[model samples]
Target: MSERITRLEEQVAYLTKTVEDLSDVIARQDRELDQIKRRTQMLMEREAQRDLDEGGSVPLADQKPPHW
Candidate 1:
């Protein structure tokens, strides 16, 4: 009975460590995703401003496509 209890304890410890490691990975990925989103938004805004500065009456983003 003592040996079985020890084995169970070891298994629990391993699982606890695994869960902690996964949690850390998730947090890191969340931060990376936020950074990516911010950069993409900045780029889009910059592009729209550039179009306006180039004397376009309508920002390309609001203009209909050539096919239309």
Candidate 2:
């Protein structure tokens, strides 16, 4: 009975450590995703401003594909 209890304690400790490690990973990823979202929003706003500045003069990149 003591051996079984020891095994359970060891297993619980291992699972606790794994859960903490995974939690840390998730928090880091959340921060990175927020950074990416901000950068993408900034780029989109800049593109919109550029388009407004170049009204009626679409750049080559702004053109449709040949398949269109």
Candidate 3:
């Protein structure tokens, strides 16, 4: 009976360690995901601003130079 208790204790310790390692890995992945999300949002906003700066619309053909 004592040997069985010892085995159970060892198993519990191993499982606890595994859970801690997995938790650390999950936290790292969450940080990486947050960074990617922020970067993507920044790039999208930059592109939108560029479009707005370019008048946000195209002109007619007659508006072109006489080179046509």
Candidate 4:
């Protein structure tokens, strides 16, 4: 019937809008993730360089058990 077609059309319109909104959210998150990745890489590099500056000695985590 005509009413059923109208109801289906409305549902399709709402679904289309929801899809578009979700697509926008995903795009923004992608950009944020890229930025976070770059920052993490830079921080890691800086920390490594600092360790080299301080000394090349083994870190506590790498030391053998004290009972040895």
Q: Name the candidate that leads on TM-score.
A: 4
Ranking by lDDT: 1, 2, 4, 3
**Per-residue lDDT over 1-68 for candidate 1, one digit per residue giving the tens place of the 0 to 100 score:** 99999999999999999999999999999999999999999998888888789986676667899999
lDDT by residue for model 2 over 3-57, one digit each (tens)? Answer: 9999999999999999999999999999999999999989976887798797845
- Candidate 2 Cα misplacement greater than 4 A, ranges: 56-68
Model 4: colliding residue pairs: none
TM-score of each: 0.79, 0.79, 0.76, 0.80
Model 4, runs deviating above 4 Å: 57-68
lDDT of model 3, residue 63:
53
Query: How much is 36 displaced in model 1, in angstroms?
Result: 0.6
lDDT of each: 0.92, 0.89, 0.85, 0.89
Output the lDDT of residue 63, model 4: 67
List clashing residue pairs in candidate 1: none
lDDT of 4: 0.89
Highest lDDT, which number?
A: 1
Taking the candidates one at a time, how many backbone clashes does each contain? 0, 0, 0, 0
Task: For model 1, give the 10-residue run with minimal summed lDDT.
Answer: 54-63
Tens-digit lDDT track of model 3 for 22-64: 9999999999999999999899777777866887743343256
Predict model 1's lDDT versus the native: 0.92
- Identify the runs in model 1 with alpha carbons over 4 angstroms from their true place: 57-68
